[model samples]
Target: MPEPEDSATLYAELLDSARRLSFDLRDCQTGTDDADRYGMTPEWSPLYGTPTWIRMSEPERRRLTRREVTHFLGVAIWLEIALQIVLLRRNHSADPTRPDVKFLFNECADENLHSLMFVGAIEQLGERHSPLDRVMILMGWVFRTFAWEEVAYGIVLAGEEVFDVMQRDWSIDDRVAPAVRRSSHVHVVEESRHMSFARQKMRDRLRGVSRVRRYVSAVLIAFGAHIIAKGLINKGVYRGLGLDWQVARTEIGRNEHHRMMFRRATAPLVEFLDREGLLNGLARSIYRKSNLL
Candidate 1:
């Protein structure tokens, strides 16, 4: 709760927290899925009954739909991670006098690795038009708004928190084939710990900041993440198929049938922090700032 006059503790905390956060993701020791696999588990996903009327074959549409949804969202995830490194790099590149170069270097390396995986996923989805690419390009810029110091870190933390649960839920309860399980397993493995680290990092960051700023930023990050998720769902996908925008946005932004599906999307961090005995601060209050409460 001291004012964060020096970024040194933050540097150590960020690294330590990132490492700890990465642990569950790296190891995935205790994972699970929703109990129901009748394809209606979440009951709270914002993306329930998405526009499924494309002309492609069902299997092809399934793969493509999942791929498009995953690839773009993953870009937000990877690029957000990338920008964190970029922020450090921008700071360090010009000021050789900056002492935190070592930490920045570590951040850059991790972001690069994460970015590569995300890029590979994007490439795996074949290709898209210039406009879709433009949407993604613009999204990267929007994600930058969150990365402006603690806000960016918070958003990533929230996102990693979301990623851990959704992937875990999908992986656990479903009796999918082994090959597909890796898809769920790989993500759950890395993101779960990433969420943990983000939680601690936020906890540590709040040690010295104001409650107002803390509360504001936490809601901002959560709302921003929600907005980004909403945008990623897109009106065109649904409206183009003759679905109402209200119905579409509600489904992607606030529906019941897929709630549990995306519940993990918001659950891990809450559970993690609750278990850590680290929740009574500004960040804790921030957790309750949104409808997620």
Candidate 2:
């Protein structure tokens, strides 16, 4: 744990960094001739190395990967929009003069730009926005409306960290579409600052909190993580690929390779949550069910 003064200093420094970056959505290059390439790394695909995956033709595999990337980008756009709402609500009640509050506004702006970037990528891929199911829509509404402090920041960090891990790969992988790579690179660069701010906020909010409150917050955060992890890939993706949706879902459920990838992506977040005492028994169980443990 960092001292309060040190945390404050680090937060200020992060604010300075955010100001210096000032990334604009317009700078992202989405006009690339990458229609025939994969939109995500093949190994990262949910069905990678499975019998179903092995049976896929090269064109089919490329189509699946492209739809999967569209699903990911759509989910990111939804999460960003929800997070912008949460940040705006927090800023509305916070002291505007505080550096942290200023960072919140900066974060909201970044999220807005990120959403645009995602939308642009999806458009470039010739895909429309993928909407979440009603259940996830309701869960997102509850979370963005009522979640606060550690819980809010925890959820924010979980979403950003998981995406950051995957995007780090997408941004540099030569096999992925150029537009997807470019948008992912932009997201990764700007989200680093947001993740730092989220960590600082979570630590600050958790300090001196009671055990019972921490326990409850742990469950809530874990539940939020579960929702986020599950929401990334939509069922419509299989339908879009002209496959049986039920079979695809079952295969995805049994995919140890995808599970391993998910666990690896979430390792840093799990470690940080454990260190912060937010990985209680119930939280651990939820994370396990979500394949995020």
Candidate 3:
């Protein structure tokens, strides 16, 4: 209830939330059925599927494809590792006075597992390209160095901006299985709370920093998030469905909705940065071009 700082309380909440969310999600966490739960046959894979199945690909996918919904689970794995590295290296050991910050660490473990399950779905794709390569590129230059607030905000925004809508409708996707749907349900419910907590933390913690620090971190965060999105959301799906992945991403970018959601998703961080006086001229130009405002 109190305004959060980079202190013990934040750690406490992070621990509490992580525990509840992790416990609740245990049912869907089992990876045994993940590969089979969907209609994932080689026939279902655009790679080897019947012409009829390939031809009948959904418009949303044809229009804005991503890897199997399950793969998102896997990508979540690297993200967790990346964040944990940051937390462990940067954690204020004495800050354990706050229950929330503890929650962040605890939740990080669960989130890591959740993301691994998602990534497992991706590995199932058997791409000519390595998802690990994509993961390394995104994590190194993008997510590695950031003000924790930006990382916190980015996670919530990803959930609230994109996946919030995605989780609900994916149940009907021929690509997703019932078990995965059950898992995603956990993500949807728990992440909704996580989003609120992350956003709240952003609002509370990101203030009062030097304007320069705020601006730098925001730009960095957005840049990093964009790279991951392209790799995961853009390239990952097209290839999974056996399409010309590169061409499809280019084509889908022309779609108004995806572009809009992207901008909207990253907007809060941008605005937060702007208020902190971090928007350099180049960053401003980029943000304007992003058309997220």
Candidate 4:
């Protein structure tokens, strides 16, 4: 458990971090257009290096990549919405006078802004409808009702960290669309603070947590991570492009480059979970299935 003073100091540092990273979205040029039609680096695509990718026409590849990026941001928006609800519920009864409580409010506001930015990107990229969007909405409502503090926070941490790795790449890669790259850069800057806060909260939640509880929490966390991993790109994307969604999903699974990227991206979080004894037993197996181990 963190000392009161320690927690307070952490919150102060987080507030400083947030202030330093903050930006006004109105000033950002969010207009995405035909010029922003480039695909991600081959390595970032699930079908990269596969026979399928080699056979794809340049236009088809570009369309898929653009749709995939749109889907990615769409899922991110959903995840942030769910996270905001979970965080709000966690802090529902918090002492408003505390610095930590104020920080929670600030974090919620940050997530709201992020949601807008993500929505803006999707709007600019032409919306791709997916059945998974409805599922995500239902899941968000269901998950919000339960204040599974440790489990919920762990999912948030895992999701953010995984995307942070991908976004870091896009933020610097000139080949990526300018709007996509700029949005990523903005998110990377702001989310660094949110990620720091989540890590601290996860650690605090795990401190002295019982083995039985840890076991249940670990499974739940892995399950959540798996859903998030699979949810990033929905079948609707492939279907919209006149391709077989099932085949695309299968090829993505067989794409070692994609699998390795997931494993590498999640390495830090997995190591942390293991050190905290939250990555043992069933949790480890589940992560392996998700290619996150």
Reference-based TM-score of each model: 0.59, 0.95, 0.65, 0.92
lDDT of 1 by residue, 52-109 (tens): 3333444433433443444444544554564565366446444543324445555556
Candidate 1 lDDT for residue 162: 58
- Candidate 3's C-alpha runs over 4 A off are 1-66, 116-142, 145-161, 171-176, 233-242, 260-293
Model 1 local distance difference test score: 0.48
**Winner of 2 and 4 under TM-score:** 2
- Candidate whose lDDT is highest: 2
Clash pairs detected, candidate 4 = none
Q: Model 4 has how many clashing residue pairs?
A: 0
lDDT tens digits, residue span 28-119, model 3: 34333433344221222222222323455454332222244444544555565665666555655636535555556555666665665455
True-vs-predicted CA distance for residue 51, candidate 1, Å: 9.2
Error of 4 at 81 (Å): 0.7
Worst 10 residues of 2 by lDDT: 25-34
* Candidate 4 Cα deviation (angstroms), residue 206: 2.3
Of candidate 4, the 10-residue stretch with the lowest lDDT total is: 33-42
lDDT of 2 by residue, 93-161 (tens): 667767777777778878888887777787778765566877789998998889887888888788888
Per model, how many backbone clashes are there? 24, 0, 32, 0
lDDT per model vs. reference: 0.48, 0.84, 0.51, 0.77
Ranking of candidates on lDDT, top first: 2, 4, 3, 1
Of candidate 3, the 10-residue stretch with the lowest lDDT total is 39-48
How well does candidate 3 score on lDDT at residue 291?
41
